[model samples]
Target: MFRLVGSSVQLDIQDPKPEFHDLFWVINRENNVVQYDNKRKNMMYYSDYGGRVEFNEETYSLTLKNLQKTDSGLYEVRASGDEVRVVAEYRLSVLDPEEAPVLTHQLSRDTCNITLTCRGHDLSINSSCYKETCEEKEVTSPGGVILSLSVSGSTIICNHSNPVSWKTDVLEMKELERLCADEGEGEDKVN
Candidate 1:
């Protein structure tokens, strides 16, 4: 996936030092020409939908600003040196920040079990822990979901994320032991 909306993404050419050729064009997935700098300094051929395009001749990198879902797709940059060649290729994707997951603890006298949940706009998943460590998380969105369990000095961190963003909830064993007296639910959200 690519950067989020309103962010800029730069697809750079592999070469450290690039030659400033007279004819260069960057095309998007739909065959829509995004940019063109013909021997001039920072000029683009805005034919179809220009949106927000920036072409850097010095580095031969194309930066698309104020990104949107429509901008997600394959991108190809063709430059003319000895002959016309596609120097760079990219598949970009953009999505909004997912909603933060919820973590609740079920403390029964002497046991601590943490529940982790992800509530995104279009996705929801649940996982739980029964011991000092958590089990391998199983999520619905296989391509975009990442669930990890890490043990800190005195806490266990349950992190949930997608391609564009992530959120975490911590379960401190010592802290829970202290707060369990209340016999109520507790939640910790990470931004």
Candidate 2:
């Protein structure tokens, strides 16, 4: 059983026995079995039931998006014919996007390193970082992904992706310089 929390629900099934060529089936609550198109390799939906709905055979998953309350019901999936029947109940609850992520910068003058950190409400899962000119990197940390860019350009773009969506933050080198200069000035005053 899979819990789909988003607007679309995905169902994946695995068949190790390899008894059936087609691995899954979707049935509505009215006892009508959803038809699958072997040529298109997707589930076919009629205008009576609603236009054509599709599913991926390779992944053994079906995605139903823009779901309405009427879409909520019991969906049955049969794998390998009668081998296994997976019943799933869907309850759709919409939620607003949480707070925007807070982007922070860390600069090391001695090392010429600039790291941009994006902190969000949820960070338990891994996050990824991408640069416009550079390759993307993934980091596993409690504070999310830290994008390390050379402090030479005026602007650096960093993208963070979680399970839900991707968020981008643009950092300017001038801001890092100002922050480093401010810290240095504070230290000099103490000395």
Candidate 3:
């Protein structure tokens, strides 16, 4: 059984046996009364029993939310009957939010081609660049890398192996059209 002490608590339960269905229940530690039913797969709001919960089967776990100060004590579970019983005790504690990763991209243009580069913050080495039909390539270092594609319409992708980060960018045909127009204008001026 997993003890949840504060808000936004979620539980992931895995069942081992295909035949028997897993069951869970919560008991109020202070009052010694059943508060939740895991078999029904339901959720309870802010109640007296915050983290006091248990699972009936070893294969499954339970998650409780909106934990309060009163929610502290022992939790028990019965897998089969009087033969198998699992017990766990927990104390509720509050926590703060977590941070997310940031992504950035850079594009450079020259007369012949254009290069698009993608970089991730504090990532691992072994990164690679690829096109739609090609396989993954390893990037030598963790820093930014460039992916070169024709000025024509094509898709390019950059991937990192260790931290598992990837970015995709497309080369627009408009760049080729502009290049051709500039060449035509230059030829006309020379004529």
Candidate 4:
């Protein structure tokens, strides 16, 4: 629904009565609709996110297809003839999905040491740990990303999030144990 950034969005007001005199669509903070609606007078405009903006003349509704980050803003329907009155108000929010971080490497050696590097959304985090335990793990927090787990568990979960959207990835230490088990066969393996 409204949780996606490149998704289509609709702002509709039932019984908008746009046929009324001095009634028009107001975008952001302006009376001009050309910036939003490209088909007003024919030809084309920016289309926001390589899409189209449609204004239903019959229903008095505004629809922006293939929305983008710039489309997040306020919209209003008002009548400015005799007495100025704002009939309907709507707010559109477009949010991008949280980028997933990759747990790249787990090197097995003495002390059960491991090294991991995660890169996503113009951010990179490098972390190292011993025994692969949550308590012993050392991770660096990157932009809009969080790494959390419990000391008593062998599962390491890394989460990338924002106020509106988030994504998570889990690494099971049990599966990784086989990779680091060649040498030091029983040295504090992830059990």
Question: Per-residue lDDT for 1-191 in model 2, tens only?
Answer: 22223366665444433334333444464443355544466564544335434566555556666544455456655543436455333433333334445556555554334455555455422222222232224344442332322223566544444334455556665665676667678777979
Better of 1 and 4 by lDDT: 1
lDDT for each residue of candidate 1 in 103-180, tens digit (9 for 90 to 100): 555544434565545344445455565544555444546557665555576776666677777787776766654554
TM-score of candidate 3 against the unseen true structure = 0.28
User: Where does model 1 exceed 4 Å of error?
Assistant: 15-30, 35-42, 47-51, 80-83, 107-140, 179-191
TM-score of each: 0.66, 0.37, 0.28, 0.58
- Give, for candidate 4, the lowest lDDT window spanning 10 residues: 34-43
Flag the better candidate by lDDT, 2 or 3.
2
lDDT of all predictions: 0.61, 0.47, 0.37, 0.58
Distance from true position, residue 67, model 1, in Å? 1.6
Instruction: Single out the weakest 10-residue window by summed lDDT for candidate 2.
Output: 125-134
With a 3 Å backbone cut-off (N, CA, C), the pairs that clash in candidate 4 are none
lDDT of 4 by residue, 71-134 (tens): 7777776655557666777776677877775656567456566766555555555666565543
Look at candidate 1 and tell me the lDDT of residue 190. 19
What 10-residue stretch in candidate 1 is worst by lDDT? 182-191
Q: Which parts of model 3 are misplaced by more than 4 Å?
A: 1-59, 63-111, 123-153, 158-169, 173-191
Better of 1 and 3 by lDDT: 1
Best by lDDT: 1
The TM-score leader among the candidates is 1
